[model samples]
Target: MPSKKPELLVPLNGWKTLHNSSTVLDSADAFYFGLQTNFSMRARADNFPIKDLLKLIEMVHDRGKKCYLTTNILIYNTEMVELYQTIQLAHESGVDAIICHDLAAILIAKEVGIPFHVSTQANISNLLSAKFYQELGADRLILARELDLNDIKEIASKLDIPIETFVHGAMCTAVSGRCYLSAELMDFNPDFSANRGKCVQPCRRNYTLEFTGEENEKIDFEPYSGMFFNAKDLCMIGHISELIEAGISSFKVEGRMRDPEYIETTAKCYREAIDSYFNGTYSQKRVDEWLSRLSKVFNRGFHLGFYFSKPGSDDIERTIRGNQAKLRKIQIGKVTNYYPAASAVEVQLFQNHLEIGDTIIFENKNGFYHKQQVKSLQIEGESITNTKKMSTTQPIIVGIKVSKKIPNTAVIYKFIKKTTSKMKKKID
Candidate 1:
């Protein structure tokens, strides 16, 4: 029998990125999403409306894939009924599994006859705790993010259940995301708990230092000096081989509240890298290419956290400027049709404007990535040098030569034209 390919479990950020998930469904083995209830970690995300969520589960199951419902939030006494209702909904919706951080969710999963996976928030770092979960009938274990590769390998070797880990995206300073910094600050709201999915992210706040007294020992720290707790994002494309070797059954992506483009780009990159590594065609050039794709999204800056070694002070970024989204591409257009005989594509402008010589790419629904240059543009069959934003009635038509099979309704992204001062001076 052939060994199973490592699964890539991507996040469903919210309703806005739902369209983008189609691009990644083929690449991802499973998808985990949250709902509007307390059972989610991303209450800030759109999650899914009840009707849409049920439809989403059916859609995913129809594709012959698994869908995991995330109920990984801490449970309060008052919220028990609501939590169980969510679990029942997940069960009735035919979700393959439930990821839970709360004991209440685990008990409910058992009653609902659905399998459960312990969320990383459970802090299952050692073999004994893992055995405890397995004894509880847990189907999978998403071990804490703090476990190093050696520890993961050792644990996997000892356990029968599959092991999952966060391979890319953000990391939390607190172990297993047990954080209280948000609720303690900013007027101390009783309802805003990061564990419960309403985090204000006080860690991303900046700080500074100041002098407060006559004595030399009276030097005081300034307010808003730097992001002391702001951790860098994790990128493990370079370590794909080691992770697969560690017997990790799943490599999870961490962003669910980010832009859809970010979701599509990151998933596609990792999917290709994993396929290449296992097929014996892995190369440094390919690794570098995937890294470049990761940079196109918002990051807290990139690092391989606790995965390889003990994190030092260097792992945590202490800068005033936080890493937001860097790779911001505009949705300049979309393909309405393709003409093979002419070796061209028909795209309607959606946002921004594109010139004839601009660099852009055509992203298909199946996550196919293709780069092409704008060779021609026409409106009403008349030639034009450039195209601007247009309405449905007067959208511009772009003809770019292509070789690959472009899927119907592919998104076209115009690469931002970055011109430096020196280059501008030369042009002037």
Candidate 2:
């Protein structure tokens, strides 16, 4: 392991992700989030409003964790006024640091008196490039995604500031995510620039080919036969020990548009892995378990990225078309009533049925999330084994005993393993 424990920097999109990620995983040392502005990379996400920065910062600080606001998008003269205001607000609201890509943002952060971490978009692939940013007063360097373990070690050893790198989530097929395919393909949309953070991922879509021979013979190709540009999602969990020992200062997860359950599971599993490494309990068996848990969440299959060597054809997940997630949260219904003293909730069925021994989670608009296994199911005053899956027009209310109180507005979802048995049925 490194001389100091590395920070697990999780992504935060909104209050819901923050509530789940912070509470479910104590291994999460800090959170990086984007605001509802074009200056952020995740403009399509449920980003927090600038007005709520103080409240968001306060919530994170109450849990004794640091917060980093992302102002890491390419800027233009039209966005200059808003960019300055955003950085100034971040500094005033006690954001620990601002993640920046453009030199203008770095200068603005310095002007606003906020610590800044150079974004991966800056493409600091070598020692000199890293040193260039460090000399410019960067508090940390989010190294280029193309670097290997050896390159990271060298930079981390020489740099006085912390070194951060992506440990999990989506990987861009381009070099350090500097591709213009999205911008070129989506030319009609003014905000489709990947540098501006509104990427319309045409690369991920399956493509087909057509050919015309010299004899004027036309040929058609099958759909999904060409996914040449699709890159597998990056997964470093199995190599967490190597990463911790690489002299890096922080490990960051790269999904800002993921669901709360996705955030919770990733944070919890990574925390377990990190803690196990330092506590002398890390092993192949534990790593296998963590890998299995991670596989249950949303992913496009996993690869070791460039940490080991250059990615080849095998690194591309060709078999799977889209999400390779094994687990799916099926909405059961919404909580219509709650009995606080008895620690029970009354749910009105909307889509699926619920039964004893089923795993369920309750979520509300205010970012409250509570998960529990159904120990008992009651209908009115009678106990039942299971309810039909929305069999009738009448509302079916089921009472479930919860460990804690849940809000009436909380929607219930059942975590179920995805099955391919229903795939052919839909097509047929």
Candidate 3:
């Protein structure tokens, strides 16, 4: 058993960069920001410009993390040449690599002399497909999500190329990269194989089955349905050892549509697990702790998925409601401008009331929560008797003595909003 640790790859969509920077910066070893060309038929433009894509790449790189630009959509028309040019620009802008499912785009990437990764949409499910991609100059292969653990191990043993597997996130019931759910149901096409970037995910929608009488003809089903076919998210946090021993090179987290906090927390958990495994101290308890943090986000229920085998009825969840997706707390103040001579921190409050000796917490979008106690109050560069009188917009200084360093962006709040009554009541 060769004991090399696998790399952690986090996928970032355009929307993930907005609120998840704090999280993304802290969690991912590297990131793949997705789909610059419009994949949604409903989108007005043909493509998101390379300039916009570069800004995101720069943002991710600024955080000292590696970034890969995705041009992985199926191409259908010549206009997609513009999309190819955008990938070229991403190469020039110094992205770590380009991800593409279309062979034409892969050739373009090679022509541009940039590194490339084969997208799962390429549907590399077997050793032969993996070898073909590796021979094509692909640096990594995102294995098709449909493969079982046995299949993965078999391929791993047969191939020398680096293999990346989806360790956590949603699973598509459709054949890998072959979904027409969007085009059929939403009337929008993803345009990848057709060489377009737009996609409408009709598969995630709900549908009711209808049966007709008199010769067993089918009748009209319900107009609206819930997520009947969507599988629970693939969560392998508890199975780190199995994956590490499978000879996989990278573990991927999928959430191009998720917020940054979700990206950061999930990435961090896997990173820790992989490192722990390689360091010879991997513990199930630690893995479970990391998974519990992930459960706090908005997600479908968790399952082992096809990694174990075909998902059973018990593996799918129709409804997914957890983790209040909104920010429930605000940073009231930070312990700043502390003086060793004065023995107090000049705290600034953003929106909450606090008193001397009151306990306060600071949390970021990544869900890194810490607490500090108020030792004294200060305002207008002077010690004040009443700190609670400060307005919502005002930054009131508070004096606090604590062991941990208070982060500047740390939101100081007295309470985290009770997103779940059961959890909150239990805590209470």
Candidate 4:
């Protein structure tokens, strides 16, 4: 029931993101990433080096996808010159658009003659602000995360430009992520501010309530100890139809600081959801399956976020402190060699043991990933059922039958499944 199919905008953290999303999944319609510089959000992430900008852009373009460079950080007066250079370099490297919020960054993008997408940091929650950005030549508007589906529809109905919104990922406790808590905690350190993209997430910590009496005595309340401000991750897999019908131009998935495996699962799951919606295969059963798959990846549990209405106490992630993923991956070995004709790879074990019927993932440094169940394992080309844990000094080598070619630089990780009856105390 959408006017048109929306774009699946994904995040790029590093080389793994490039390989997994582009090669392993091939799902993203566009990718948004930050550079090594601090002008963009997710400054703590393993951002791409500026020297690789041209090559990275070429890689995405070769696959017929667009690249949007992120320069959405709050700019100080001293950083204007460097910001201009960054936007200029993005323009030179054939970037599709520069995602930014600061007026200086917006002006610089315009000066450098490049398209710009207003970031959610702009907080364009209403029609007036949406039209303002549209008039300012914003190719796309990433509306505030605080807006509900009705508000989104109302604004999208009046806007001519494409309107983008967060369909999934971490929901900041603050309005549109304009938080000073991290900065205040760091004693006004600009490098640690949420607006500067390096939030330490003090809000996610379990805090207790303390009371001071007239005698200067302190009392602690044990019942109030909880992660009150830790917002549950946004998941719209079940509501893809509603989101599409809201006239959103793009569905953005947050998590630039997450691992590559997280990126792969999220991108693939959302991609399937969106495609299924358009292909007339969207169903509650499929949604359930997608939710199960999503729960296996990195998340702080799931919620509908502000799409339906204001979040209440039920929306807050009160118990789990870290990831609530149902599965954990452990690196066990690396591919030492690949046999194309035999469809096999020589693996050198570094740690844990591997056996038949085990689920494993092959990750390449050059940007390729594959997951398969270990149906075939061999030692010196002879059939084997399992192998012992290899030592670091005298590592054990074995042959694995792969479905496709795996690079020599590819690392292997075994998936450790968990039960739903009880949650693990340590999540890793």
Candidate 5:
């Protein structure tokens, strides 16, 4: 009998990600999204407006993929009514499940008859806690990042509920991303609460390490020698088989605030790796290819985090705090007009072009995104053959028509195709 393929649960930061990025939708088995409320973990992201969430859920269901709504914020009594309402709305919208951290969220999920997946923020690290959540009607538990593979296997063996582990993306310096650094660093502002989805991310800043034995005197230390707060990003692309063999039911990629390119690249890499393993064609060369793709997006650095054993000094990245600008991809153009009847948006080029047979993403400020190829183009009502490159300092404007209409507020991005280190096709 064949083993069950572990589900790929991905993050959709906002409406743009949900609308654009076909690569993510095509490869991912399930998706998790945040709403524009204190109930979400990423309040800073362009989270889904309540009005659009219903439409998003319907679209996700229509695509035959599971959708998980995120209400993982730290809940208080004042927010309980809002939380219940959100869960009720989610249930009505056909959200397959809801991932949450607080016990209030669990109770609400249970009350609403929505399957609850325990968030990693709850920090389940042992068999006892795993069993407790399972008994509380938890459908799955996203294990804490601190757990080693052996620890995960032990919990998986002891529990009936599924064990989900993060396979890619950034790691928090604090345990389970529940750091109080932001709240403490800032002057105790209520809105800066990390659990409430407004983390200032003081940890992701340059910190000057200092040691002072006496309070009256200032000790001299290297001025901002390195970003000690920054930990290296996690990449398990090379070790997908090890994770799968360890009995993990799901592998998650962390980055709701990240761009569609990151989502697409990570999804394709992992999908290829997992499929290759199941197809009996897994190879080190294939792993290298996936790794190459993973590096092309936003990441500080990549290393396997605490999976085999405890992470050593090699795993911590003190050189920088924010994502490393390596293997970088970014916005190249913006939409200046929308022709809905013709299914096109007028694009303004800043740095790149929309050429024939080239993939482009239309990310709307009005809360929608979609991927399309440049099939046709027009300049001042004149037909032009493909590519439109900007040679001057001013933005170049042109009409673009595709399979779908793009909003006027949307900005278009051309996928920066690199010619370096071309990957060979896999042999089955």
Candidate 6:
């Protein structure tokens, strides 16, 4: 068998509701096996609470995965000490490494005896900067997104330290994310000096195009049009071999503020694609399938972006829209306590209509849905002939324990119909 492919580094910003729970990390570990928690959004000067940070790091580590703490924000004099303290705490808490952009912060990280990775914010587009970081004891360098295949190959040939590059996801119009557009427009600076956590994404806002007529007469070319700086989402899932050959050690996905389902799906896709590419049988059909799945989540339209060159007019999508919610065909029930000695399973049903012999499907951490026949039922501690009017507190007993330990949040649902003859003919 071929060697297992290297893992992708998924950076999460803890913006969506799922990132607030332990289940998100659990799901990520189950799917991706590696993650990077971004502190750029969470580490404000006033809101430097380490409770959630510690919890997230602990959960990631507990799953036997690596967690890199991001100190990749633009730091000012006022926030320097607080940032250092945060880095120190992260180091003490056994974080894998600190991702830093500022040289001063990198120095502080070095003094604290924690390994450092240069953040992409530093704009290491050339081989010299990569070499410089390697000599500075940096273990990894996130390359600027503007670099093409040739640039990557040149840098890879010269660098000794591990190189990380964005394999898929959003593209920033700014050079290496160094744009002052948000700060300049909102009057809230976000560069190397003033470290403000709140960034009003000025790039994604609307704009109106104006035209100049004869003798300085102005005309409205396009009214109230948006996507002014909206670069298309980068999708390089189709080009894995070229990237791996360019010596990229880690393929990074850029969705720090996206949903957990987005994280789960995207990470899993890249995980599989990387494996297939290395095994020498990667296909375009598989890439299309993964991209289609991603479309169901969220996106600003897809593009190959600057990976090839400066993105053309066709590379950008001019409009923005939200993804429609796709409801899952499952229902959740109250969890039960497991007892191996009694060989009995108990679950609280949301609907009281389930019979003893009814078959139902259940989902677990493995993402596999299993169908099982219920052999028996009991209410309370005694056996009951019928449980037609069961209450929420009453535990409904089943015959067989699920193959996998049912997570507290496990959802169960009975299939209403197996197949439709007409639908099958349409598919055929």
Best by lDDT: 4
Estimate candidate 3's RMSD in Å: 7.2
lDDT of 5 by residue, 1-428 (tens): 13898999888877667565456788898999888877888888877888877788777777788889899988888988889999999899888999998999999899999998999999999999999999999999999999999999899988988989999998888899998878777777768978677888777656555655555445555434455566788999888888988899999999999987788778888888888989998899998887777877888788898898777778877655455634434577877877777776777787866567777777756667777677888888887876556744967778877777666777777666544332211111
Model 3: residue 260 alpha-carbon error in angstroms: 1.7
Candidate 6 lowest-lDDT run of ten:
419-428
Cα lDDT, all candidates: 0.79, 0.85, 0.67, 0.87, 0.81, 0.64
- lDDT of the structure predicted as candidate 3: 0.67
How well is each residue in 173-244 modelled by candidate 6, as lDDT tens digits? 778777666677755544422233345556665566655455433543543455668677788888887787
TM of each candidate vs. truth? 0.80, 0.91, 0.71, 0.89, 0.86, 0.68
lDDT of 4 by residue, 198-227 (tens): 999998988875554444336433435778
For residues 280-311, could you state the per-residue lDDT of candidate 1 as single tens digits? 88899999888877876767678898888977
- Model 3 reaches what TM-score against the true structure? 0.71
**lDDT sort, best first:** 4, 2, 5, 1, 3, 6
Off by over 4 Å in 1: 20-22, 210-224, 324-326, 330-352, 356-381, 388-428
- Where does model 5 exceed 4 Å of error? 214-224, 325-333, 337-346, 350-359, 372-401, 415-428
RMSD of each: 6.4, 3.1, 7.2, 3.5, 5.9, 8.5
lDDT of 4 at 63: 86
lDDT string, candidate 3, 227-290, tens digits: 5676777899989888878777888887766654566668778888877877777787787788
Residue-pair clashes per candidate? 13, 0, 28, 1, 2, 1
Q: Candidate 2: deviation at residue 136, Å?
A: 0.4
lDDT of 2 by residue, 189-250 (tens): 65898888889877776666554444433544433456777798999988988998888889
Give the residue spans of candidate 2 off by over 4 A: 210-224, 339-343, 364-368, 392-395, 403-409, 421-428
Ranking 2 against 3 by TM-score, winner = 2
